[model samples]
Target: MKALVLAGGSGTRLRPITHTSAKQLVPVANKPVLFYGLESIAAAGIREVGIVVGHSAEEIQSAVGAGDAFGLDTTYIRQEAPLGLAHAVLVSRDFLQDEDFVMYLGDNFIVGGITGLVDEFRRARPDAGILLTRVADPSAFGVAELGTTGRVCRLEEKPEQPRSDLALVGVYLFSPAVHRAVRAIKPSQRGELEITHALQWLIDEGYEVRSTVIDGYWKDTGNVSDMLEVNRTVLESLEPAVRGSVDTASQIIGRVRIEEGARVTGSRIVGPAIVGAGTVITHSYVGPYTSIAAGCRLLDSEIEYSIVLSGSAIQGVRRVEASLIGRNVDVTPAPAVPAAHRLVLGDHSKVQISA
Candidate 1:
């Protein structure tokens, strides 16, 4: 079996960050989000892989060159546009050949990995298999309806009136038969050939479609909130270690991993956090669920439940929480300016001036 991972898209939700970097490359716990998916794929025993890439193809390739580090022989396939999920499959047809493959969304995070799901698919040999999870907002996802026998009966993409709360997770398994399904399906109203539509096509053609509702944690880390949530979730299982230097003035509490070359002085870092290699934290409060990336400097700053990317510096900032700071950013006190009061008052507006 092979794997097809989709790492291409205009990540509008992540804005300025995505404008400069690939969304999949965004770090969770000081590691690229896509790296976890690649590790999971390698764990699933899929050797040959094809990565679908678009505008950020070069960056993806640079980071995942040859994929040997992840134990997969990867081949890059170009998708000129971010058409849709099924369109990715269509473009990767040559690399996928007639082999059964798993389509893993690069930016999606599935906590327990896909080994079990792949094994189940191998046993069942369904024409197509989809992973589903119960979500609070079904309308935000491609919702699915199941039959009495647990087969996928129907699906609707972002329906105004959802029939079920089971939303589609980003992992999917498909046999060569899906190639025909993708070809037979038409583009949706959104002008893209959605994978949901392709699966619906398979169901209409009398092919067996399987569905599994996973209870494990899963997320599409395309937005800031989800990214931070995933970071916290991953950090929960952290192991305490201090390979770096921590001065006597510093206090490190539970489950903190201080990477080599990192230094902490006069700082109190509390549990479930990571200080990446070469990062220095001084006279600051490094709170729980925070990941400070490599080569960063945090001086007299209090940070918690946040991710600070590489080469970034936060100095003299009182507090930072639940933030996704990008690479090479500098967070410092803004230069002071003369105080003034300029107001456009409403009917009952009250103003007070300081002498």
Candidate 2:
């Protein structure tokens, strides 16, 4: 079996961050969420991976060049547009070449990795397999209704009224028979080939479609809130170490990892947190569930429950929490000005000004 990772969606929900960067590249625990998926695929012992890239193909390619970092030989498959998941399978046919493969969504974070699922699929060799988890909002995902025999009975993508809460978890394993199913299904009203429709066709054709309900941590990091939550979850398991310097004036508490060349002075870091390599934390409060990425500088500020990417400097900012600060950003106080209000009120509008 091979691996096919999809990294090509235009993440409009995460703009203006997605406007400038790929959503897959967003860091969770100081590592790109995409990298975690790739690492998981590698750990599953199946190589010969193909990455389906679209709008941010260049960025994805640049970061995953040759795939040596993840110990796999990767081929970049270009998807011309933001077509659906089945379309990605259709375009990657040449690379897949009749081989059973695992399709992993690049932006999705599954805490325990896919090794167990991959092993099960390899042993069972099912016609198709899907990972499902019960979600609160099944209408927002591709949902499945399973039968008494543990077979997939029905599937729908983003239905207003869902049959069940068993939402697709963005990780799928398919045998080569899925190619015929993809070709048989027509594009949905959304003008793209829906993977759910293809899977439905497989069920209609009497193919074996298996599913596993995951009880572990999994998240689709498509929005800021989910991204921060995943960051916190990953940080909770961080190993405490101080490879760098923690001066006499600083207080390091809990499960913190201070990487090489990082320095902490006059600061109080309450972990489950990490200060990445080359980062400096001085006179600030680095609170729990926070990850300060490499080469960053945090001075005279207090940040907790947040992610500060590489080269970012948060100086003199009073406090930041539950935030996603992007790469190379500078967070400082704006110049003070007299308080005033300027309003353009509508006709017959009741307005009050605080002065």
Query: What's the TM-score of every candidate structure?
Result: 0.96, 0.96
lDDT of 1 by residue, 54-104 (tens): 999999999999999999899999999999999999999999999999999
Worst 10 residues of 1 by lDDT: 346-355
lDDT of 1: 0.94
lDDT of 2 by residue, 101-206 (tens): 9999999999899999999999999999999999999999999998888778999999999999999999999999999988999988998899999999988999
Candidate with maximal lDDT: 1
Query: Relative to the unseen true structure, what is the C-alpha lDDT of residue 88 in candidate 1, on a scale of 0 to 100?
Result: 98
Candidate 1 Cα errors over 4 Å, as ranges:
344-355
RMSD of 1: 1.8
